[model samples]
Target: MVSQTSHVYRYRVDAEDTIVAVDEWWLAFAKENNSLDLDEASVVGKSLWSFIADHATQKLYKEIHRFVRVTGNPITVPFRCDSPTLRRYMQLTITRHDKQHLDYESVLLRAVPSRRLALLDPIQQRSAAFLTMCSFCKRSLIEPSGWLEIENIAIKLRLYREQTVPEIRYTVCPDCEDHFGSNRQKLESSSEQPPR
Candidate 1:
């Protein structure tokens, strides 16, 4: 078990959603994760959308941002930011900074050591086959078995016997879409004024 450090990384963006500033914690986390390209110097001034790989996840974020802006309320959502050997659970809170700006704070909630799958290893060799992964839950789509966590998928598919792991392609799983989608709709309806 990885002890909870409660590490928080924060960044701010303008109305156009371009990253304006990132805190030192953000930089430190990126370095610790071996994500050099995510360093402050490279990430600052870039569109947030540039970092998101898939459209479904991007759309979910867009809706969350819009909800915060319109309702002037902060929303916290759970997500996974996993490393090859660790499953990192995190919570992201989006708060309105002003009418046209927002602040995003991500806190590490929990982390657990798990058997590593080459599929999650950035440096691992990849096969031609592609695996569709849920961006929010870190689950992979296994046909006939539906969406499954990486550990189960690895065993079910017997990836250990393969020379190379399948490449990961990210998307939103139906469960996540339904959960967030319903909440978004509720927020939208509540924020609407009835009959002026």
Candidate 2:
């Protein structure tokens, strides 16, 4: 079980996506959630986007962030991403605001549930079955959050607690599959280009 982290990832980053300020409490949170071996020094001044390790998560964030930057609006969503040190879940709240006094336009990111907590789902089925999971990220299909960690499948599906891990059938997740199709098209188009 991961220790509940102290800091809640409430930080402000510039429009350029560079973190300009951070909370000291988050330092303690980083200590607890230390997955990617990051510290205060590593976080501040770094591109907020650099922290994401999951391709699917990165892709999703890119789209969401693009819209926020363009629209200057706020958004809140439950996003699962592998943190610096572990695979964890977080509730992300992003807001667009400008500090008139400082002449700064940036985004505020507030993260909740600083640790990876087990998800309990009420299930009527006791029998285990093959589950579809993401081929790349390994996040299984789970309720509420859609795709989550494979550990969650057993809990959500109510599989045998004493039994070994259930079998997982690999398939590209929807988001990644979409990106995969787009990437393949780009690759094909580039391949058709005359070698120049």
Candidate 3:
């Protein structure tokens, strides 16, 4: 039986490198946070790389597995994944095994979202002209007052409402900074809460 550990993903693989089982908590995390659509039972015959969408990450997984399989040595590495929607820092721990019941490699991954990364994805892509916008409200508090219109920013970027691209960036517009700047306690509390 697999034990439950928050933020950790535990799974076993057969000698053939097929995923045989997944832990309960890992399934919950996959459903709630993973962008990949995977079923607890259905994931079993598939290659672990099949569920990973990022090209760079996929390559990383391949290299790591190849090394372990060839050398029969255990390895542990920490890496980060950043996309338009989510950013995570994860530790990949791989161990080689030859147990009677499960004779193969097993991976125990523990990941945490980067405190520096936003929890939510951007509504749309930024225009060619980059703009500093509010994270909570998704608006530009640029000079001359009020939030900038999506259309105008689009024009500057030479993009259309139909073509805005989502990307990752860090900012806290003056409006928010000013409003909550003095109220550190309120700002901290509110920031911890997901945006409405």
* Top-scoring candidate (lDDT): 1
User: Which stretches in model 3 have alpha-carbon errors above 4 Å?
Assistant: 1-7, 34-36, 53-56, 81-87, 99-196
Positional deviation of 192 in candidate 3, in angstroms? 52
Q: Write the per-residue lDDT of candidate 1 for residues 14-71, one digit (tens) a residue.
A: 9999999999888887777668778888998999999998998898888888778777
Query: How well does candidate 3 score on lDDT at residue 122?
Result: 38
Q: Lowest lDDT 10-mer window, candidate 2?
A: 99-108
lDDT of 3 by residue, 17-115 (tens): 678877765666556544346677678778765666445445444554555554554556543333223334445567655531132222334333332
lDDT tens digits by residue: candidate 2, 1-196: 2323323556777767787776655555556544346676788888776865456556655555554554455545543444322454555566655631011122223333323322211122223555666744557776567987655554566543433344545555876566445434443344344422
- Clashing residue pairs for model 2: 35-84, 35-85, 36-84, 36-85
> What TM value does model 2 have?
0.47
Q: How does model 1 fare in lDDT? A: 0.83
**Where in model 2 is the C-alpha error above 4 Å?**
1-8, 80-89, 99-138, 141-149, 152-196
